[model samples]
Target: MSHVFPRHTRQAPPVAVAGDGCYLIDASGKRYLDGSGGAAVSCLGHSDSAIIEAIKTQVDSLAFAHTGFFTSEPAEKLADLLVANAPDGLDRVYLVSGGSEATEAAIKLARQYWVEKGRPEKGRLIARKQSYHGNTIGALSAGGNEWRRAQFGPLLLDVSHIAPCYEYRERAETETAEEYGLRAAQALEDEILRLGPDTVMAFMAEPVVGATAGALTPAPGYFKRIREICDKYDVLLILDEVMCGMGRTGSLFACEQDGIAPDIACIAKGLGAGYQPIGAMLCTAEIYAAIEAGSGFFQHGHTYIGHPTAAAAGHAVVSAILERGLVPRVREQGDKLAARLTERFGQHPHVGDLRGRGLFRGIELVADRDTKAPFDPARGVAGKIKKAAFEAGLICYPMSGTIDGKTGDHVLLAPPFIIEDAQIDELVDKLDTAIAAAV
Candidate 1:
């Protein structure tokens, strides 16, 4: 009798009634540890009184104000805070509803920047294969996950996908990690030349590949070379930090660790920390100045852009992260979690790789560790793990298609920044049980 549509048609999920710290409680009173932070969204956990009070205070005074007619205080303050802490050169913030909107706006802004510069021919977008940006049309187009794009192929834009900086499977035995990184980055330059440098506008990628490829961290100097190539070709580097930014990767911005900055950056998930629906697309001062000097308009907008209540919530979440010293805590707790995972799964026959930064981590499963071969797609290893974990009162993100878009599986763990040491052990224990049952 339920009319509400679900992501999967055949199964009905338990109704979540409440949240307590890092655990979610269903109507039946089962408490599930939020191991994946609900797709890496709840960085501050479910109940933070400071963020809750901020939302309440803002809503009592002012909730919504159309950005066209006015700019609210909360929105302005949040924007200022974000830019102040953002990567060097990124000075402007365009608030949106969620990750897809942030990335979609980034794409449009990139296109508009080129157009304003009188180079309308620079329209092609290049992204990495096995990357997931967002779900909207433009965001989806920029994303290279084949299975997600299979049915929507006709609706997607023509985007060229280069190989990802995946060190594990792609690196050759002959090359050192640094050598492999440089070789991987060369693909971007090669693709830009093949497509004609003048025809390419921007290159988009996640600093730590999530979802589609799990938390796939780039090798040393990988992003540095990417930054260099983009600079040399006059191509904009658009980093999608939707699921990995906002201190999720131990830095306010994930690219900071890579020692590079993007021409444009997209962030969400941890921004509002599941307290509100909010995302922001930040750009370099140069890009913002282009529109300011020319059209004085970005020619793109959403009705919910600059929503005050969401802004207030985001501001509080970020302030809590910075003021309460949670970023370093993420690094500290992340080390513990990583060590626990390695200790538990390092010798497991099916566990192929354990990788990621900060609280964001990934565990790739394989049929043969020696050959690094994936489990057969028909085995549904990821799906089974997810089900088993959930049944055991744990919530983790496990996805298929970690290799291409079909033949691999990985479990992504992104627990809250406030998680305790005992909780870390609990998370790994539950995950170990899940993997054992699944594989």
Candidate 2:
């Protein structure tokens, strides 16, 4: 009987005692390969010496510093590095404790930016129905994961959910990938016109849809059309990269591959590489200038916003990512992983789709390959796969409701950047065995 609340009420998880390389060790000395990098948070693997040393040194010197009173060295340096490497026009960073907080701040910041710029009526937000931003009240409101938002519907703010750029299921047989992408992006324009562009503040989306939709990459030219629409309508573009950013998709920012920049972008997960709880909401110079010129404050604060220890950890993690040339390594290893997955699961009857970019991959299961129909929801395929995988000593993210909130199943794979070629085989083998046992 444990007093601490857990995500699953019926079953308790093993007590993880240590992590070495990409494997986590339980108290019983069992090792589980981190196939999904613990929800894609540990990009540097579990035992990163540089990050550990940085955290220790920072805590030994100065552990905490409230953002209200003073700024810390690590925070400043980290912000500078992030801004330097961030998408074009994004010039500022607002540190937060996690992904949810970063998204909440982004939503509020967008609203505030419109208000300060004499467009207070522009309060409506538009997101994709298959996307997920975060879990906080504001963040949840922006997210379109129906299952997660089902219970909190009454409390959520009004947000418009347009069609996601999911080429796998949504694209038509007659249209080319580029044609489907443009057609999908047209949904945003249609929604913006329906809501009256002046009444719309921001359009939020993930460059690569993770978690809910299982690493759903957009079709070619999708984001370019999205960017054009946002520009034409004067609506801010907010890209939520909480799960797919920070080198998870090979590049430091997932949007880089998309070849577009957002007015605001939220990033976390791999930023601290599981060494610290940290996330940041980055904004364009234009948006930052609006707040600076009007209110002189963004109207957001958290006690731990600029915690020195966390900043130190982030700085070290990012430094390692850049200096150690891990981003290129992510691309190289990601290709190998994809090739291996394709070779293994391409012909598997249950595996319908194998898609994604870099290291963030998704395997969608289907009941009928020809029809691409999902297994019945009652079957609990996702849940069963998760259990079997864990029991088989492999940690992967398996979630239900890939098509919508109620149906479809997919397994998301986001291994660490440090994973070796041999480890990739191990990951795929364990997952193969797990799927066999589960199905």
Each model's C-alpha lDDT?
Answer: 0.96, 0.94
Please write out the lDDT profile of model 1 over residues 1-439, one tens digit for every residue: 8899899999999999999999999999999999999999999999899999999999999999999999999999999999999999999999999999999999999999999999999999999999998999999999999999999999999999999999999999999999999999999999999999999999999999989998999999999999999999999999999999999999999999999999999999999999999999999999999999999998999999999999999999999999999999999999999999999999899999999999999999999999999999999999999999999999999999999999999999999999999999999999999999999
User: Candidate 2 regions off by >4 Å?
Assistant: none
The candidate that wins on lDDT is 1
lDDT for model 1 comes to 0.96
How do the predictions measure up, each by TM-score?
0.99, 0.99
Model 1 is weakest, by summed lDDT over 10 consecutive residues, at 1-10
302-354 in candidate 2: lDDT tens per residue?
Answer: 89997899999999999999999999999999999999999999999999999
- Give the least accurate 10-residue stretch of model 2, judged by summed lDDT: 130-139
- Where is model 1 more than 4 Å wrong at Cα? none
